[model samples]
Target: MSRIGKKPVELPKGVSASISGQTIEVKGPKGTRSFTAGDDVTITLEGTTVKVTPRGLSKRARQQWGMTRSMVSNLVVGVTEGFKKDLEIQGVGYRAAMAGNVLKLSLGYSHEVNFEVPKGVTVSSPKQTEIVVEGIDQQLVGQVAANIREWKRPEPYKGKGIRYKDEYIFRKEGKKK
Candidate 1:
């Protein structure tokens, strides 16, 4: 059995949950979000809690049970408290800005990189070196952050690039005589 699957998800007060077919919808004071249940996973609502179970007795089904449960739980929490991702521009001249729905990035490249921000998600860089991505959908927020970081990943040598605020880049000494 899946230990995480056995843990029941407690619905916060004022938050509502509904499961329809393969989709689970969660609405709270903060916002509303929905995600599809895994193919081998089944969800049952019991009072204020939702129980996640597998549809079969196989190993794959067992593996999906806990993951589906955790994904649903995260969706609920995300819609309630929202999700946030912080990125830092490390290079001296590297920076990011927002214009309309586009993210303008200057990563010491010859040309600026223009990224279109998706709907339902917000991106802001209060400080020239720090970028913040926020949204009610946890997966999308994280994906956007990853995409932004990919534009200019931090180098191990000088540690000069875009990276997560809490991320660590192990640096190596340069060649010396």
Candidate 2:
């Protein structure tokens, strides 16, 4: 049995959930989100909580049981609290700014790099070296942050580039004289 799957997801005071076949929809103050489970699992709404169970005693069913439960839990959290990702720009002259729907980045490049923000997610630059990504969908928020960091990943030698707020770069030794 799956430990996480055994626990039902509780709906907060202002949050609500509904089930339609294999799909589950959750709505809260932040926004609304939906998730459809695979055929190996069954989803049910019990009072103010949601539950997921496997269809049979098979490996795939057991795998889907835990995964489906986690997905449903994410939906509830997404609709209620949403998700956020923060990135820090390092190195001299490295900075970021938000211009309407575009994120302008200056990472030692000859020309400034313009990144267009996608829909449903909000990107903000509270400081020249800080970037914040906020959205209801966790995956989207993380992907956007990753894409921005891809422009200039932190190098091991100089550790000059963009990186997550809590990330650590493994510094390497320089050439010997």
Candidate 1 overall Cα lDDT vs. reference? 0.90
Count the clashes in each prediction: 0, 0
Top of the candidates by TM-score: 2
Model 1, span 1-177: residue lDDT tens: 899998989998988999899898988988888878778988888889988989989999999899998998998888788999999998889888888889999998899999999988999989889899999888899999999999999999999999999999998999999
RMSD of each: 1.4, 0.6
lDDT of 2 by residue, 1-177 (tens): 999999999999999998999989899999999988999999989899898999999999999999999988888889888899999999999999999999999999899999999998999999999999999998899999999999999999999999999999999999999
Question: How many residue pairs of model 2 clash at the backbone?
Answer: 0
Against the true structure, candidate 1 reaches a TM-score of: 0.93
Q: Which ten residues in a row have the lowest lDDT in candidate 1?
A: 30-39
Give the Cα error of residue 35 in candidate 1, in Å: 2.4
The stretch of ten residues in a row with the least summed lDDT in candidate 2 is 73-82
Candidate 1 segments exceeding 4 Å error: none
